[model samples]
Target: MLTEKQIATETHKQKSKFVTVIHPEKLIATKTTEENNDNTFLISWLFLIGSLMFLLDGFIELSEGLSIHVLLHITASGVFTIASALFIPKK
Candidate 1:
């Protein structure tokens, strides 16, 4: 029976037989369309979440009364929401 180490070594050798090591330049030359779509999706979701937070902050300010603390929270949330909307990519 083969030892554990010997079996592992044989498995590694077999795996390497089908492995291709492409150069960095070759990899950079490839275009990935899926990556762009995924990025767009992520940005849209971020923007949506930020908008929701902004709306929630407004509601809190209206419902709970505009104290200094509530004003600060609303201001901070608004800034973040605008920043997200501006930075995130659109589909």
Candidate 2:
């Protein structure tokens, strides 16, 4: 009868057999607390700003006439803008 702790250890050992990890600590080291909120907030806003700029550039190019290129530019910018929103800090 294995204890819960022993079971978890055994499971981890078995999983490690099929996969090799280098610098496993770094995988989990990035998470902490609210201290990272500021960085996330700034980076998310910057990313959104860049996306907006790209969208603006697409608009400027719009004067050239609507075509596949303009549509693609607007689409890519929209995707990145949505992704950047995921990084916004939660309250």
RMSD to truth, every model? 8.7, 8.2
The lDDT values for all models are 0.78, 0.85
lDDT of 1 at 49: 99
- The TM-score values for the models, in the order shown, are 0.48, 0.59
Kindly report which residue stretches of model 2 are placed more than 4 angstroms away from their true locations once superposed.
1-32
Q: Write the per-residue lDDT of candidate 1 for residues 42-76, one digit (tens) a residue.
A: 97777869777776967667686767777777777
lDDT of 2 at 66: 99
lDDT of 2 by residue, 1-91 (tens): 9999999999999888775667978977877667688778888899989888998898888888999999999899888888888767775
Poorest 10 consecutive residues by lDDT, candidate 1: 82-91
Q: What clash pairs does model 1 have? A: none
Clashes of each: 0, 0
